[model samples]
Target: MSGEPLKKAQESAAESPRALRDLIGYHLKRASAWDLHNANAALEAAGVRTVPMSVLLTITEKPGISSAEICRILRMQRANIVPVLAELEARGLFLREADPDDNRIQRLFPTAKGREEAQRMLGLISAHEERMLAGLTMAERDELRRMLAIIWREDGEG
Candidate 1:
């Protein structure tokens, strides 16, 4: 608590290998990997073959969102999404139907079974998110999220 020792502590803290920013980035990358692992495990437990979490998330959000929109929001190419879409469709998770309003557009929709699976997937996602945010206080978590969002936006990564 004395001035010199406190200053030395602060200096050491700043110089540590796990300084704040580096720690944050390190944990962020680790958490991303952990999320994917947990999601895959959860899917397996639910008797579902593993698929990309991105596809499951997109389908869950907009059951009938257009393929183009998925491509746009995820910043993915048609080539990347097509095979995944085909596999999901083949697995009876969803299907692409031409838009009645615009035949040129193909929209994704979860079948009845797909809807059920989506709900289960969401449960898994929620558990993973809860685990990820476990230690932070609510305010701290919110501030961290806000700060990260601002950083992303400023860097044109959002």
Candidate 2:
């Protein structure tokens, strides 16, 4: 959507009970919901969703990254990340190797096709971010990202 449409949509959300705005968490939740819905739709064509794409990109960024490392980087639990790992492996997007020195540990590395898919997904995600952030100027976008990083860091999430 264009800046005008995004602005209108945000205004519509803001029209909700003003009392809700008293808490910053409400705005975060609202923005998160909006991103979740739109990002899911944006990534649907690649048979991927936001969380999985995030995992894929993370793995792509760091080859030989272990599942434990992924859990730490993404702040995911072993149980929650298990299924996602299984799905990605089953899809041939990545492969796991036993640590040479520690066979009990498994490391993740993206396959050739996985790299190809990552590029495509990155493109899609870039376009999606462009549309979603259209309402904000470049400076506002940078500040928004910095503020969000601080929020994550405060919770030891980043």
Candidate 3:
């Protein structure tokens, strides 16, 4: 390539606006990545990752919630949830029992240990989120969360 063409290419690349940063989707994904990294680091002491943290919180909040219900609420597939349930159960954090009304349906119940872990994880998560949004004022953070909820509040239209 000619030096002139190479120079023009580099100049254009350098001068181009960061349009991706202006995009809502781009910022959401990037922020999510940063949250994941920080949350994982903070939760490492608990031996739990983000998904498990969510699942544990859910289970603790709604005891007797079924794995299927968890799938719907978490927007996760059964295949992904099953392993997490297994891991939590093996750790004695929670247990599944056959539903009284339907023998086939298994309900999740967080044990005493699971509730304690959930409380601890929540504290860690709260700290991590506060740190992540430390630059934002309280009102801005509240508004950001409210706006984010509205974006995901409804089912997608076909």
Candidate 4:
């Protein structure tokens, strides 16, 4: 085959759907892993080592948010959140109480220490998020967020 035809064939192969999806997936996964690593490092630098991402997310959002609410928002299984909640409770970072409105429900409330730690962790997380989103313009970032939300909705996650 001539060099020109070989080049054309290679170009077409690169544009194939499977190849495109693989490329997209590779970059997406890499970015996600890097973000997670950086976030963990940031949290550690802020003197937090044992807190999981879910716990941080929950605590940062509301001081006395319920565990059931966390599970629902995070789409996490109840069993998966239980051990983390137990650990956080044991550390005296938070307390769980039976909801007065519904005895079957458990409510989560951070202790004073937990609130302080959560504030520090939130600062670290904000810094990390700023770094992660540094390059994109505000409009571009908004668009990207919108697109991701669409994907999540399609997957029944939003």
Reference-based lDDT, each prediction = 0.71, 0.87, 0.87, 0.72
Error of 4 at 151 (Å): 1.6
Top candidate (TM-score) = 2
Q: After superposing candidate 2 on the true structure, give the runs of residues whose Cα lies further than 4 Å from its correct spot.
A: 1-10, 155-158
Better of 2 and 4 by TM-score: 2
Error of 1 at 46 (Å): 3.9
Clashing pairs in 1: none
Per-residue lDDT of model 3, residues 76-108, tens digit only: 999999889988898899988999999999999
Worst 10 residues of 2 by lDDT: 149-158
**Per model, how many backbone clashes are there?**
0, 0, 0, 0
Question: For residues 69-116, what per-residue lDDT tens digits would candidate 4 score against the true structure?
Answer: 787777778788888877777777787778888888877777887777
Q: For residues 30-79, what per-residue lDDT tens digits would candidate 1 score against the true structure?
A: 55676677767766755653454567568867978987788877777878
**Each prediction's Cα RMSD?**
6.5, 2.5, 8.6, 7.8
Mark the regions of model 1 whose C-alpha exceeds 4 Å error after superposition.
1-27, 47-51, 154-158
lDDT of 2 by residue, 1-158 (tens): 44677778768768888788667788899889988898889998899988788889988999999989988888888888988887788889998899999999998999998898888898988999998888788988999999988887855454
Q: For model 2, what is the alpha-carbon lDDT of residue 133?
A: 89
lDDT of 3: 0.87
Q: lDDT score, residue 100, model 4? A: 84
What's the candidate order when arranged by decreasing TM-score? Answer: 2, 3, 4, 1
Flag clash pairs in model 3.
none
Please list all clashing residue pairs in model 4, or write none if there are none.
none
